[model samples]
Target: MKKTIYLIIIVMIILSWNIAYGEDLNLSGESYVLIDAETGRVLYERNAHKKMPMASTTKIMTALVALENGKLDDKIAAKGECIGVEGSSIYLREGEVLSLKDMLYGLMLRSGNDSSVAIANYIGGSLEGFVSLMNKKAQSIGAINTNFANPHGLHDDSHYSTAYDLALITKEAFSYEEFGNIVKSKSYTADREENNYFYNKNKTLWEYNGGDGVKTGYTMRSGRCLVSSATRNGMHLIAVSLNASNWFNDNYKLLDYGFNNYNRQFVYDSNQFIKKIYVLNGNKEYLNLVTENSLFYPFKEGERENIKLSIDVPDTIEAPIEKGDKIGYIYTYLDGKLIHEGSLIAKSTIKRINKFESIINKFKFK
Candidate 1:
């Protein structure tokens, strides 16, 4: 019995060590990253900041900018510049008109280069203006290392985005319900004269459980690039692979690793009561404090118990407190590193006691 117990103890120690260190995924991508879609926390990354050309994935941003700037029902005519564009296309004809929604379906599901140009021209007034919007959106969303030279992901030396930046862009894009609906669609039929049918090229949606959106890209210079997203047990993860030899399989491993290792846990809810604070000389003796925003974070195995929450507030606050007034802050940390923070605000108004009331209270106490 003693020998068996010793062996079990050794095995348990090994298993605990393995869980702490994590497994090495030896992915076939030159640059790859897996991130929590909700928290934007990176679960795994390998050379993720290295910039590389992304082929048709450029349409992701194109679709996003179009959705933000244009109405889905607006009719946009294909420009002369979109005709006969090289690479994948929806075979757009000059002067052909399609609704912004239909054009987006073609752009994402079919990887339509011409569709990108059409959306760009109609929404931005010119291809150059549209590309500028793409770059600006990228930068605005913290994709600092990314640059967009065109609406379509053509091979341009100036057009490049890193895996990390691509994941950031994907996270931002997924915030739109319309964009998510469009990319996850496997088939779409546009209401046009001809060649209106499209089938999504992303194979992960069919093979992987809970697989959804994103885009795929390929060019001789860029190799095969893929951005994939999956949701399991309320955890949405986004994975990006650049210059990957096995783009689909690489994402599978990346996403599988993320799901297997991390679990999304709700930390706080918006307007959640933190604690009551004593209010001196106020109509109310105490005021409730509530959080400003909700927080959810991914936790690794055994890591939940280690999380620490610190609330910073005064011991007693003076009266005249207004609802929603900033009073304090609540910070959440894991392993001594801050993970999330939110403002603690007054939950209700607390008017100061009138002079007469104060005098009466003093007299009653005496």
Candidate 2:
């Protein structure tokens, strides 16, 4: 369940399309969006939430499910589910067994539709089961507009996602070190099959600076769908373009806008003041609260006004409070929604007072 955090945006002209203050970017996709990989902020968007065909980009989530659920060394056999799927393939035959690592490389690098079925069947026990995991993962990641009817992202009227949803999915995929490493590789070789080789389809890896792992997709119905990620000067960005005539260029422009125009701004430093908590039945009546880590986020020019910080700490806590106790939270919001948060911890320990100590404290005070 998503809880709303109200933020007062002074600019009202771009509310409906999910646009924050950023450089004016012209893209060639029917639907496209840019987001902060760490913060999930929609730095720029056009028809972001409007659902459309995402084609092979659906494999991003498929790869994510595989990495999260299946062991890399787990041996998966090519079965009936993998036979003659549409689009691209690694040409796996029944009775052939390959490591999950090889299949993942094939799925992302070659966009192997057949490998998708093999993984879905082996890890999920069946195609339907894998599809269930896909949908559940989507919901878990707050991608409400996404639905995965197939693991390989072969076009189905029911299998569709918005640009915003795809970006969210890609960002989540990048969080996994294995997924991130796989997407960025220019080439991958099958560990079991010496002759098998796969090359990354995301052209941005070579054409764009700081290019990392991501996925590219296409179908006649979906046109060209591409999800691209990049890191530059400590800022990571995810760019999604759906039905694009020129996806590589569009993604390049999107990333450039994010890296060149915005920066990661620190709202709270580690050990920063949060609030004073009242203590009951303790040696001290109040305790200072602070954050354990610094909170930093990407923001565009003139967009700092959209960011708001709030501290929600209990008015009073019980005795025996210890240092580093998480008694509250420090939240950061953008456009009236929470973008980041951290625990509010006690700055110092406080001990409880026994009956004898209380009696002695009375005389000492006098």
Candidate 3:
């Protein structure tokens, strides 16, 4: 009995260790998440759902809101109310005229609070109105654990975001090439005029290889928060660290883990032939259905063959089909679980076959 009890305790200890650190390698932060930008899959996470003060990372959402709602080339006049908001600044003075694009550069790369307020005022008519827009956008993007009290990420209790939510928001932000370009720029010179030059403050663009420009933030109340993105070998990843003891180390470690462990594989390429379906009474005897967009998945080296492709197309299609019409779907599976799903669209239009033509073909073939 004593021997059996000892053996049971040893087994329990091993099981507990495996349960705690089975899939993940190492993680150190109050909250952290590593997500594949292509699929939005949470590769690694710790305390991701816990809401915490998000410091300057909040500006990512600010930049996104401004980019979508405001025009880039439109000139924005610095209102007297936006002059001295506080925190990080682009050193804007009253009556300063700058393009919306330049301000966004400052807002994202420099983490300027004044730029946030100015954008909020310009796009939403007031900071309050802009906060409303921000909340709405957050909800639309499925950022449920996020709230916006200010355009700038000050240490208000009301202004907080979870690591998972930050990853989700940044993933959406990356979809806009304009936004992605601005954030990824290591160093850019923004001209307020012929004389004034504003430089980006994000040092990661210069410090790290393949480092894209992203916002960094710190406050006594918020501790240290950083949202960083990097692209390697055609795979993009977003890493969020909230209240981290060492922001640079944590960000680098998490980003490296994602890049090293995972690779973006084309599960389904656009216009690639997925399946062929017979057409009944149509001009074309058969129709080729293909994927509309390239489906991507994060996979390790030996896991390629384990990925299964299941094409769920209709066996027979009807006539009068327009080109590019969605007919069915392709689902990708890993270990019998669906990982990615894409639509199968008609490759070419199929007009109805004339009754005489159908009869003649059937008789001739017979």
Query: What lDDT would each prediction earn against the true structure?
Result: 0.90, 0.87, 0.83
Q: lDDT: which is higher, 1 or 2? A: 1
lDDT by residue (260-339, candidate 3, tens digit) is 88988866678999789998888778899988998778987878789888888778978989999999988888989888
lDDT by residue (127-223, candidate 2, tens digit) is 9999999999999999999999999888899999999998988888888899998999999889765439898888989999999969999999999
**Judged by lDDT against the true structure, how good is candidate 2?**
0.87
Q: Which ten residues in a row have the lowest lDDT in candidate 1?
A: 17-26
> How big is the positional error of residue 110 in model 1, measured in Å on the Cα after superposition?
0.7
Query: What's the TM-score of every candidate structure?
Result: 0.87, 0.87, 0.90
lDDT of 2 at 244: 88
Q: Which candidate is the best by TM-score?
A: 3
lDDT of model 2, residue 181: 89
How would the candidate models be sorted by lDDT, starting from the highest?
1, 2, 3
How well does candidate 2 match the true structure in TM-score terms? Answer: 0.87
| TM-score, cand. 3 | 0.90
Instruction: Indicate which candidate wins on lDDT.
Output: 1
